[model samples]
Target: DAGITQSPRYKITETGRQVTLMCHQTWSHSYMFWYRQDLGHGLRLIYYSAAADITDKGEVPDGYVVSRSKTENFPLTLESATRSQTSVYFCASSDWGSRNEQFFGPGTRLTVL
Candidate 1:
């Protein structure tokens, strides 16, 4: 079974283009999260969903959006890509009440020119 997976492991786009990153997990976890990893910021949370339709904004959400209509899938979209938004994004999931341990997918590296 695929524990967690991310699509388009790497992406390069123009400054004004839009980019969507996909994430999927076989485990039916109640919580899912999207995080971006950068040099100084480490891993900053971009968005999170407690359940299928309950989503919330995280530390960095200005240029990104996320939705989870199904328990196993959570996708993040950058409305208008920018060079500052270029970073390695990671998707993670955890069961309810188990916030300490999360399963993370192979990250997606996005570079905006």
Candidate 2:
């Protein structure tokens, strides 16, 4: 597989619980990103990593954490899930920069009850 994958594809958890969503890519792309897409809205960046050991927060990084210790994997964790956190989480990767074409994974639908 030369693309990205995310799991679990769907998750339902109670509020205040911690959950980690996994993302994996085979291309070892230089840049990886985590975004959440709510209904009828554009994707909002949560976190991103330039390369191994290099990570940064994006526009809506609150309550979310990310790490890129490995070049091909970036995981996102919700410290304390809230109803607002319930959305479709998409994982994407690019060669570099915001202008680079990004490839997206199927996505993880997280529901916080």
Which candidate wins on TM-score?
Answer: 1
Looking at model 1, report the run of 10 residues with the lowest lDDT sum: 94-103
Q: Please report how far candidate 2 places residue 111 from its true position, in Å.
A: 0.3
Q: Quote the RMSD, in angstroms, for model 1.
A: 0.9
C-alpha displacement of 54 in model 2, angstroms?
0.6
Q: Give the per-residue lDDT digits (tens) of candidate 2, residues 3-80.
A: 899999999999999999999999979999999998777899999999999999999999998888899999999999
Tell me model 1's lDDT, rounded to 2 decimals.
Answer: 0.94
TM-scores for all predictions? 0.97, 0.95
> Which regions in candidate 1 have their CA more than 4 angstroms from the true location?
none
lDDT of 1 by residue, 10-113 (tens): 99999999899999999999999999999988999999999999999999999998989999999999999999999999999999878558999999999999
The lDDT per prediction is 0.94, 0.94
How many clashing pairs per prediction, in order?
0, 0
Model 2 worst lDDT run, 10 consecutive residues: 92-101
The lDDT of model 2 is 0.94
